[model samples]
Target: MMQATTAVRGRTERAGGKRAEWTGGLSRRSFPAGFVFGTAASAYQVEGMALKDGRGPNICDAFVKIPGEIANNATADVTVDEYHRYKEDVNIMKSMGFDAYRFSISAGTGKVNWKGVAYYNRFINYMVKIGITPYANLYHYDLPVALEVQYGGLLNRKVVEAFADYADFCFKTFGDRVKNWFSFNEPRVVAALGYDDGRFAPGRCTKCKAGNSATEPYIVAHHLILSHAAAVKRYRQKYQHTQKGRIGILLDFVWYEGLTNSTADQAAAQRSRDFHIGWFLHPIIYGEYPKTLQVIVKERLPKFTPDEVHMDMLQSVIPQLKIQNMICKLVVFLIVRIMNFLIPLASPGAADERNGVLIGNRANSDWLYIVPWGLYKAVTYVKEKYGNPTMFLSENGMDDPGNVTITQGVHDTTRVAYYRSYITKLKEAIDDGANCIGYFAWSLLDNFEWKLGYTSRFGLVYVDFRTLRRYPKMSAHWFRDVVTSKN
Candidate 1:
């Protein structure tokens, strides 16, 4: 087990007039040696030039077309123009002392998008030229429009072989230099939101005039697990010997807590997790879905074949609020079972306040609340329940209003405090024997957030959307100290 320490606190005064260092007993010395620290971004979310240079329309390109979908009627056709300005973004990381940067391939979903190929090659070469390391993700919710138009995307088993082909190509093309890779980011969100509520690309659901919310989510999720395992199998068999790198999948899970000390609420909390994280993690790690899911979901869930079971890399995204477990279970039940034809997606968690009691600080998004201790619970739960696989707090960060002025955006004390509290609890999880190797803040720069579009900013560094300029917020400096500081 690792041990926690009383290290220097991150900077908070840069945002607010109050110049108080974080009182939490956490600092640079709290983490283990060789621990990685970095910032993360996605392709569809950050990379601009959606239709340029032979690239096809991704699901994001299609989803944004519907009226009144994204906030402010926004589109990511030119989101911070990362495709044209990756060098500038890398420079920001180099200056802030981040050890790595995680970005996904936004090109052809299956076949070669030569434009995307050239762009990623340029971006990776630049990152390697500088001191920063590259961590590439294979998928981040932007499915190829071609597949969805032809075979209904993840809903069909055909996507399994298609995704494998894509993964194989990526490993062969970029695996030599880009050593760290994740197969998918937030597969849970992709399953629930896209197939259940119709909120994302390739949108389909009972409520949206198409899709079977009850069965489609499970099918999509099962195929995603298979796809991940297939990619890992190919990599281990073919590339692992030469590339000498690790591969994994990223999952997002919010911590659950009962509203009161009642048995009902307590059971609700446990059941909610069995359906949420256990829905995917249990299958990948244990080679089967949780028993609770088997009993509750019945034949709606798919089974893995004997030859199809290959345990892949598991990366748990550690953020979001501590949900009211009773409410959480009831809501998931409604969406998962009762409201089969009236499907609704799961938001961040239960209501921000339960029965007139606020959980913690609220982020700009209604679904997220500031609950630092939830970080400890999330990591510890995965550690104890899932055999403590080598883990990374793959994605953890909160958002602020995007309409704020550049001056106000940079002086973001709320964001600074959010990072300080969450990271402290993260240290506590590490101390309690969780095998967490690294932490990646949700984003390095303010880019177009999916659904919320440009309305919610979740970046350590603020990006001037108009000029595409980068400014390190107070949290960025503190992260630099946390990651690079050696005492």
Candidate 2:
């Protein structure tokens, strides 16, 4: 029944017919059978029962305390209150017919917090009862405050032991129910935003009061990769067999198209990609950093142990970005490579790297530009580079300003359009033989967006921060029909 409906939708899309009126003629049937569709969320962003019973503060809790860190100084202390209302949220997702639910474990004190475990157990049980597969990520930017103050988070090799111990607890506690495990989500972001720019939790950077962006990002990333390997090794050694689960890491990927087709510009674009996604991924896949990075960054980049170079059960990702005008950023990265011996910058999101021109429509965020084609290039690049590993389009969505009224909010035609364009390109990539298995929108609710705080709305369900009520936006209904479609 689904295949037939999908075929009809495909024909209508090709014919430019009535199906276009509803959802651009796309639906879950539009992709391969068994491809998962869901929404993604992180612990700090959604679960707001911070410090309730036996909980501990995370680095984010500390970062937001410093004035002016988050937009409007907003905090996720109660953003969306998912900790208290996950049952309701799970119900919504089940009714929407999404195949999976992607969320993270909350950060806690060094010891296992049964209070945290109890909440997840109930949440996972509800999801299982309703047939929603749980994709649990072990970490998502929220390092326990103790970890940072005690041994220096991610920077010191000691973090590898601490993280593995934490991972062991999670695997032993939840692995029976959760089959899909992600060791970390965007570890590069954790290193870059936290250590290199001091823009995130435990903020540290060259310009900050006490950081060495020149050396710390690489050190942090190296430790993160090692930590991930340790977790994967432990899982494989003990639980993976009886538990029947697969583990992987999520890396943020961005495509860099040359500014003008000039050879230098083109070379710069390649460097941008190598510096960004290639920085962490290359090491795990081939046991070393990208050759370009090793040559440029030299000793700043760390080497992996022979034991640290094993294959993860899977290679998953959240989303891919593209930046075209990184012409100037190329020079900056080169300079940083000389000064710090690290891949200092990422490819353009929409060509703002060193003020190069942009290719497509701009969004509210200065760094974001709509470039659907970039998604195709990103997944395809990963396919070619990493021997065609299975991937999850774990996150892909745009945000509108939060100040938009409820009436104007659900009319999110722009966001709907963004999803349409990006997903279509993603489909194109899959058809071209990329090994993508699923795609999740960035969020389920307009909870706190890190850095931007409540200033951005990237949710398909419009959230009224005042009432904490969730109203399905146009995109939500569109996604519903796509998932539950029977033609």
Leading candidate by lDDT: 2
Q: Write the per-residue lDDT of candidate 1 for residues 1-487, one digit (tens) a residue.
A: 0001001123333333332354234455788877777788998888888767877888889889888998888998889888888888898888777788988986476446676788889999999999889988899888888898898888889998888889899999999898887888878888988888888876888888788888998999989988887777777778877898777778777667766667766666777777778887777666788888788778888887766653233221111101210001000110111011111234324444566767776788767778777778778888888667677787788899889877777767687678888788878888889878788887888999888988899998788888887777766766765565564
Per-candidate clash tally: 0, 3
lDDT (CA) for every model shown? 0.74, 0.75
Q: Can you give the lDDT of residue 393 in candidate 1?
A: 80
Residue 388 C-alpha lDDT in model 2? 66
Query: On a 0 to 1 TM-score scale, where does candidate 1 land against the true structure?
Result: 0.88
Q: Candidate 2 versus the native: TM-score?
A: 0.88
